[model samples]
Target: MVEVADTAVRAGLSGPRHPADPARRREARAGYGLMSPALLLMVAVLALPLAALIVLSFWTQSGFTLDRTFTLANYWRLIAPSDREVEWMGLTFRLAYPVPAILIIKSLVMSLTATVAVILLAYPMAYFLAFRVHRNKAAWIILLTVPFWTSYLLRVFSWKVVLGYNGAINSGLMSLGIIDAPLEFLLYNPAAVTITLAHSWVSFIVLPIYVSLEKIDRSMLEAASDLGDSKWKRFRRITLPLSMPGTISAALLVFIPTVGDYVTPELVGGPGGTMIGSLVQQLFTKQNNAPLGAAVSLVMMLIIGAMVLIFLTLIGYWRMRARRAA
Candidate 1:
């Protein structure tokens, strides 16, 4: 009789028509219904435009006439080998169309340089904010963000003024008898673009790193100290790993958007520093090749996506190795 009662109870609990199932189903339905609007908005805002871009990439445009018929000529032109060869870092690439290839390489180098600079510069400030500052921390954060409140254009222009031949640096140096002529190399080059981008994005990168560092548990550090670990060792073994999520977030935040940034490159890049974004703009407007422009944009997006995926994969592998060692 006891066995029979147990079997019956088990069946009731696992049955298809369980008593609480209806309420659970209703709750799930309500949750999905609540999320439907946001999902729709994302689809409308992001997905639709991306789909259009992809479709346009496959079409061909010529002389104010757009052909909806699918063709791969534009992409082929980008990918096919040409007679000219360029060597870099022990590798040679035969670029069919050198403009896109050169611009893409230039943009990547500039973006990476800027990202590294931002991380290096922001980390110390963020570390100070997280661990050093005790009182009026909010005021410090506000001060850090004050430069960002101005128009981004204004900020870039400010850098141009500081870096330009007749700008502040040259004038100050000239006044102080540090130099006779204005420095021509200070502006209108890759370095100038890199500097402008780094300064422009540093404040935005700091908060994420600061948040990550701030979220670290102090007890862990205390315990490490009690265990005879030096400050450097404790940070390497504890704080750094814990803060990586924010650092990685900060890196991605700067790297991805800056790769496509046309404004900084336009203002400071000049002819030598022209990025792929400027090329895309020219293709779409002056060159009147919308299809080719779309193809280049898609390729840039793909390259960014691939790089991000690889970065995440490496981070995951490192985390796994760390866990295993622990």
Candidate 2:
């Protein structure tokens, strides 16, 4: 009799037409139904425009009107280097780089320089906040984020003032009898853009690193300490490895977006600091070449994506090696 009861209970629990599956299926259906609206909105807002851009990237334009006919001319021009005569200030100059190539190379170099600067400056601040500050942490975070509360354009313009000729630095140095004239090099150059981007994105880099460092288990550090590990060794083997996810994440966050950043480069970056984003804007708007602009945009996205992939691969290999050694 006991065996029969056990058999019945097991059948009820595990067999088809079971008691709980209907309720679970209903819950899942409801969940999917709730998410459908958000999914639809995403398709309408993002997917539709992206599809249009992709389609337009393959189309051709003639005399301010698109043909809507499939062609690879836009992409071919971007891929093949072409010579162009640039008449700047009534002087004819030969440029080896097509606009697309010029923008791509310039943006890549500028963004990389800014990324390295931001990461170098942000890491120490994040480390100190995570491990050194023992009180009022929220206040520090708020203070750090204070820059973001202001408008982005306002912040970029502020950098222009600080770096301009007769701006704060130049005037201050002049007042101190350090220099006879204002520093012309401080504004309207790649250096100015690099500095402004680093300052503008510091908070973004810091927060990810801070969150990653904060997630580290203190007991692991204590255990390493107990195992005859020096402070430096403990940090190298424990602290850095655990916090790398956040560090890499912060890098991606800054590196990817800044690749196409035109605002900071536009305001402080004179002719010397012109970036790809600005070029794309001109291509799309002033030139009325949306197809070419789309092509350039896709090219930039691909390059940035490739960079991210390479970074992730390196990080994965490092983690694998560390795990194997341990």
Candidate 3:
């Protein structure tokens, strides 16, 4: 009876005593309460519009009235290839290729080209600033962002001024007797579009890369040097690996938006340089086909998402290999 009483007393005293349970529960409740406003705002702002976009993609637009009838015609128009042609200003043009594929391909090519150009130019500049500029780094950073303070439209237009006939390059060349007349091919071309995009987004690449390189451990480089590694070798092995995060960031920042850039192409792309974005805009504004536009936009988004996934996967593989090799 004494042993049983002692066991009972011990079990009663040690019965799953959870300290601060009430306090933890209250803290969790407060955190959730604090997050509720932002969550509600996101649902109202982002989620609703996205849902509406998806719904709109299913409905057909006849004249100005959106038909409640659902159809897959819009998406079919994008993927199903056929002999499509257009006539404008009494000029008939026949396309042997699919219309949607051409527009999407042009956007991908232009975006990839511009992203490469921006990173190539930005990496060197970032390296210089991070390694060489011991003083006035703040001033340099401020100056780097100065171009962005101006409007994006203005920046694109500025490129127009530089590339247009009788503009800076042509005028200078003519003045030096290198050419008799202004070069007409400088503007309204894919190269011009690519160059303009590169200049426009270079600051993005430079700033991120500089930040990444700055965070790299100098000790690693010193140890490499101590081991008789050449400057190029040290940079190739250590610095490049470390700076990849910034490089990838810069690439994504430059690539994604450039794919859908309508304004730049509309202003300077001419007929040959028109992108998928231009087509989507035309569908919405000129063609009065909101449903088709929504479908196209969704398709573009899906393609871009896929491209991004592939790129990130490749980058991850490369990083893993580099780490293992090191």
RMSD of each: 8.3, 9.2, 11.1
Superposed model 2: Cα runs more than 4 Å off = 1-27, 81-97
Candidate lDDT scores, in order, read 0.90, 0.85, 0.85
lDDT of 3 by residue, 1-326 (tens): 22344687985565435435787667657867998999899999999988898999999997989897888988887666445665533544454435666678778999899999999999999999999999999999999999989999999998888998868899989999999999999999888888888999998679988998999989999999999989999999889988887788778888999999998998777887788999989989999999988998888889998998788878778778967997
Query: What C-alpha lDDT does candidate 3 achieve relative to the native structure?
Result: 0.85
The lDDT, on a scale of 0 to 1, for candidate 1 is 0.90
Candidate 1 similarity to native, TM-score: 0.89
Could you tell me which residue pairs clash in candidate 3?
Answer: none
Encode model 1's per-residue lDDT on 29-97: one tens digit a residue: 786799899989989998998899899999999899999998898899788897889875355779877
What's the C-alpha lDDT at position 112 in model 3? 96
Model 3 error, position 198 (Å) = 0.7
Best by TM-score, which number?
1
By lDDT, the best candidate is 1
Could you tell me every candidate's TM-score relative to the true structure? 0.89, 0.86, 0.85
Write the residue-wise lDDT of candidate 2 on 96-140 in tens digits.
446667668778888888999999999999999999999999999
C-alpha RMSD (angstroms) for model 2: 9.2
Q: How many residue pairs clash in model 2? A: 0
Clashing pairs in 2: none
